[model samples]
Target: MIGKRVLSQEPVTLAEVKELTEAREKEGELTYEQTLTMDYCNKFAKLDKKKAEELIAEVEGLEKLSRRHAISLSDLLPSNADEIKLLFSKEHFVLSDEEISKLLDIVGKYKG
Candidate 1:
């Protein structure tokens, strides 16, 4: 008989982010969010709550989903591959085609 195993990864929670920033500030060191965003364009990559909320709102606006755009409650219906392609193509986002395919598949499976 083979043994069973489970794996888990830590999520990037808001509390962890606060602790890291406080620790670095105490040492007069730059925070990870600061360092990462110093050379970046959008502030969403900061990983802070305020910025994260703003980004969420912006992305929701772009996706044209409902104000209550919970992933679980989203209208995941792809309608067709062409609509999926158009929805993804309109954004200057960085996601692989494979990822898009998977999203489309999830929506199709759920709503079709």
Candidate 2:
């Protein structure tokens, strides 16, 4: 831990977290926190890695959406404009109705 340094940081979806933790567990042992995170992700992650990636990409194409927002949208897969609005409530920008509709359509495509 002392020698290791982070080269970069990026937000990731729950599906990515689930995949990474699973790979790490297969390689060796996971810490308690890691184990808990794996369990949580297993239970809560709505999309698989591929679907999450696609969702993130499509969501990111929308104007005003950041990577963090895209990842959050992928993780949550909000079904309606109201839910999407709540997700963006803390953000500085507001989404127009057309943008929200587009987001809903994109999410609907991936959501099962």
Top lDDT prediction, candidate number: 2
Tens-digit lDDT track for model 2 on 1-112?
Answer: 7999999998888998999999999999999999999999999999999999888888888789988999988889898999999999998999999999999999999987
Colliding residue pairs in candidate 1: none
The TM-scores, one per candidate, come to 0.29, 0.92
Please state every model's RMSD to the true fold in angstroms. Answer: 13.3, 1.4
TM-score of candidate 1 against the unseen true structure = 0.29
Candidate 2 has a TM-score of 0.92
Model 2 lDDT at residue 43 = 95
Q: Which parts of model 1 are misplaced by more than 4 Å?
A: 1-73
Give the whole-model CA lDDT for all candidates, comma-separated: 0.45, 0.92
Cα misplacement distance, residue 69 of candidate 1 (Å): 8.0
